[model samples]
Target: MNDQYQALYQTFRWLVPTQFNIAEACCHRWASSSPDARRIAIYYEDESGNREVWTFARLAEAANQLANGLVKMGVGRGDRVGVVLGQRPETVVAHMAIYSVGGVVLPLSAQFGPEALESRLCDSETRVAIVDHASSANLLAVSDNCPALQQIIGIGFADERVLPWRSLLARQPNEFKAVQTRSADPAILLYSSDASGAPKGALLPHSVLIGNLPGFVASQDWFPKPADVFWSPADWASTGGIMGALLPTLYFGHPIVGTRGRFSVERAFELLERYQVTNTFLAPSVVKMMMKAVPEPRHRYQLALRSIMSSGESVGETVFEWCQSALGVTPNEMFGQTEMNYVVGNSNKRWPARPGSMGRPYPGHNVAVLNEDGVPAAAGETGEIAVNRQDAHGYPDPVMFLGYWRNEAATQAKFKGDWCLTGDLASVDGDGYFWHAGRADDVFKSAGHRIGPGEIESCLIGHPAVANAAVVPKPDTERGALVKAYVVLTPEFAHRDRNDILENLQEHVRERLAPYEYPKEIEFVDELPMTTNGKIQRGVLRLREEERAQAPAANTDVGAPLVAPAQQPET
Candidate 1:
């Protein structure tokens, strides 16, 4: 609502052309117009401490060569290409090449299991896949099941059916004519899990990249410059990791720090100190993990971090307070969904952030809290978060998703009228800042009282003894469902198994929230189930609880290690 915000939005709206291609605009244009030939585009570090860097000219050439190779291999405009590699130089190059050739990108997360990978590969009808040793076996397992999949390009691994990365690059020309794409042409396919327990693909277009630029540029308190190094622990396959972090950072031509393997707290600290990362977008869970690992991190590491923005989950006030004092900057929290990224958030340049609020809606976005009838809810009334399809002049919101790929019915259900339902429960305050309650599915009722788990979970995590927390409804015969918490305690508190720990935590929530919202039963665990994007998988926890109830003999007080394989704490 400030002059600076209005100027930023107006500038971007005028600059972005009606037709766009991410690879061309972010890569080739820079390579041609400016002195970006030697500028580093990406700074990559493997888990073993090995490092590599790529420049804009080098990136452009690599992407061009790969695009030529894809064309030679029978790939054409609109073809689907899958990328299933870890965080490496090739991951970025593969994305660039796919976009250059006008092929839709299918970013298959390395964290996906065999069945999940197969489901996506088939659903997207991906013609080709690029993988490394870590994901080759999984790709091979599902290759035959994906009838449309014709080729596998290996980054490091080699086999009869696999094409070598170097060989393919060597055979192709280093000059490729960039394909022309309309603003609405599908460019990327990212799958997000829904209530049906199946992953639904959100097909995004070329305009999405340009549409995202304004919000990100305006949302950072200390806006990232070309020299700033950006990094994120979240999987690049997810919408948050791609549109929210990777592409937005790339738009500024800033160097991105790429990571592979598990997210080690020690390594994260090392990277921060070594790279002097000025701007970053991380999940709140990752920051909390750092605080739990080190009591006072401010005095421990010398960090040059200027701005820390978090999305994919609600950031608690406790995390914000710690960040302000420890990191020397109050973290900016972004509120968005997988379908539409970066809808609202705080940026000191635009407005002072209010603690516990999702900030005001970005200048160009028409967002509101809507009731069931699709009308904007009154201030303080919680309702489904929605975005208007068009503004007053009838220009469509470019950041909105095209639809759920291959699921027309699901796509139709996502829109109620002019507003696109986000399925998130929120309320707009008198100041126009939105306060997130919880997801519609995540909200539950207990004894005639509607309860949002986010409120209780935030209170539990605020306690010094608790490290990570998740709240779910436990089946109760008398009161439909009772609140239950699954928690991971800090190291100091983990050693003590006294009953008072549970009692104190229960009291902690009761004092901070309504009586009916307090957790009725608390379960301690080493870890909670999380998605690749660092969101707590409450559905999985709910399923596990239901299974335990149906068992012949179940432990009433459950406490055990629940870590998933290939799982690491990420933001």
Candidate 2:
């Protein structure tokens, strides 16, 4: 290693193994840490509490076998290997294997129906597809559609046509010639939003990812010892997942505890207590659910937890304080996205925890807030977030993605000259701390005043009767757009009268916010429509609100207040 690398190892001495590739990391842990250190157990409840574990040596062998399997199926360097498994271990192995042998891993969401999954496979020209048995039927239905798929593997039952995961592992070479790939070679392919339109693929290189690793490593508190158990609920398709679930643990020598099934607060509590889980990763929504579901007062249970951190979702001041006082651990928050990995983060006991701020950029990243035209935004001003790339500096972002996969037009559009445009809108405080706003597209004009839905939604969620909320603008003649809120009421308030509840929520909002920002209409719903990744489907909510806005009004309503029935109370 060079002087720079040595300095990093010293700086992040707490993060162990210090390997570039997952395969190598596994091999090192297996060979030196003893047979026990290499074993990873995944606790899955949905499949009849079915549990499975894989040893490091065993996984290294399996990865080699899978790479050979891909090679036999005509996959090669720069080729795309698509995975369609649910939140399962096979997906993890497949990603490492594909990249270990110089292919790119294109992960398809298990939540995807045949249509979405097939579109991605065809778009990526995937040569090999590994699907969970649950999704096999859907895959077969769409098999004839993807012209480039040459082979298929199943994670469940074996078949004459499709190889099972176990069978592939049984016939392994136990070794692979490490591909001497440049840091610039593509390794992962990720998709953008689907409901908004056609999803775009963002391609990332190994070196780009390496550059960004320092930022992620710099902020992690509590040296991740081999005895540590790490868990994260974020999916593999997202950067937060890769950073929290895979990168920190694998690179730092920490034992990770993961579930292949869905995440639950009850399960979270159970696993933490049962396994002595020391470190955990979860979204703010999950944390909120945990706070809501637990029967005892906040932070009542002690689970030997040293730290709990989160990303992708924001944690509130109350939630942050509750965790610290209840569990004896303060929650750390990190910030980053699909384009850049962990650009900024907070670590427990080291970095000062801000109640609501996401904190400054990681020690290694060259990050800045830029105005509409790309000049740096003044402190305390909102602007687009951008990263400056300077190759000469050793402290460059190694984990930035290559570009939008094969979509030059889209990639070119995002680049305002040299800076990588993060569509997220944010404001930097005078202290250099960053505050997240709603997405740029999510901002809308209401009564000629610009509004961000996140602020309204945040206010609604603070209500005692509200559980979760999503706000969108509906078309209106007088205001051009009207705010409509779809809410999930707290369990205790579920049986309340709709009008009474609406009145309470409306009055509450009007008192808390400006008249224009208050929802013109409030709709009680069982649950907010959310993406597979757990983000609210605001577009869907917007469409529902628009339909309600277009609904015909009664003849008597003609002289009534302009608020449509969709918004205004009955005359």
Candidate 3:
């Protein structure tokens, strides 16, 4: 290890107070400390270019009023209150208010359809939902299915059954006392993306925000710089958005920009240039899209971006090199899941980043690659990436989630002894850089050789013709399985001859990666299936391949022939 990183890691200590509350630390404390009530907290702009600025005092006041109103509406401590709004001022207000009232905040994405909303709302037993006009209809449509849902607070519009957000706050006093919640108290209930089955709620305590600080600061290159303005397209409903971007930025008393409406590449650049965003948390998928949309962003836009942290999927060498060359900053890639987040990541300033590798474990987190027997894997050995329940000092890790809400069995299954299994597969090198393998289930045997889709997929993306790709094992009679790839062509190469492009891509992977890892068969697709949070859903593709193997007659294509690409429905 380098002396600089060793010193930082060895000397670091988590100073979690016995009593802590996210609302108090993020909004109320800052509001009360500042002499000026107009200190800006959030700079909000919608897709239409309409803008609004919120001050700390205004945020705290609205939270207090909303807290009082929620109390009056029978919301008590530990109750699940759903905040189904987009990146608007009300979303922030609702989250703070729920936390202030000692209620568990269930942040749901506005992009969710009625079925998706119903499943999560029903699963969490969310009682009162605070929603904006865009999400209210979906929530209301599924309210009948969600028996626990009693009150619906509508932001812009209301009906006879729903209560108006403004009216509810106006009727209550704007001076509610912030709840003194313990550091270990349940604060937020986050649902998993449900790639395997139904989504599970991972209950996070108030100390999670504290646990997230080390990695957050490290990933943002020791954040809270004087002129650091933060922005991210990550949805606040998810861990990457909330813990990675929103909460940590707020805790540091920095102004964060939020925009409403769908995220577009043009809009992202516009916001960065307009707001002078200095730091951002972007998913690898979004980063790839941005890389494709504008290869030379720095030349086109006047950006102040100094640091960027990307997660969700592997950030390949192509994207890594692109960020440094185009953005003038080396993007730090972070790795974590809903249960335990921000545990491992890169800090370019502290330690040099090895592209395509998940950096050493962040300070205060004890992480290792564990074999099936739960023992730490040797250097260059593949295994599940797991985090210890206790830190290196033997103290309980604050970053760990409370447990799965109402599902103890699932929670118990998540751990092997004291290690919390992340279900992700990786291998640690001698230098402590963790290289990603595919998910445990995603890795399969092809001709007596174990192959990970991640390496092959990363190799595929390095090809200029490919915009995004997913590799899966296609069943074969001779070899147990053959490496098959589903590729999404870049806009420039979309209409080209698919047969020639397929051969070129096959050669591209064979030359760069191992010959065994080269996809024996390649299928061009309009788009790969993606989860709502913007992860390429390899499981979906895997299942399709499995089904095709069973019904060979229904799917007779054998070789890397270019048939019409199937259009995948938007998630």
Q: Top TM-score: which candidate number?
A: 3
Error (Å) of candidate 2 at residue 27 is 4.4
lDDT of 3 by residue, 344-381 (tens): 99999999888888898999999999987889999999
Query: What are the lDDT figures for the candidates, one per model?
Result: 0.78, 0.67, 0.85
RMSD of each: 11.7, 11.5, 11.2
Give TM per candidate. 0.78, 0.73, 0.80
Give the Å error, residue 161, model 2. Answer: 4.4
lDDT tens per residue, model 1, 6-25:
45444433244767888887
Q: What is the lDDT of residue 121 in candidate 1?
A: 90
Superior candidate under lDDT, 1 versus 2: 1
lDDT by residue (tens digit), candidate 2, 44-157: 334557666655555556667787777767788899988877566666678768877788888776655565677678988988889877678777778879999878888876
Please report the TM-score between candidate 1 and the true structure. 0.78
Worst 10 residues of 3 by lDDT: 558-567
Error of 3 at 475 (Å): 16
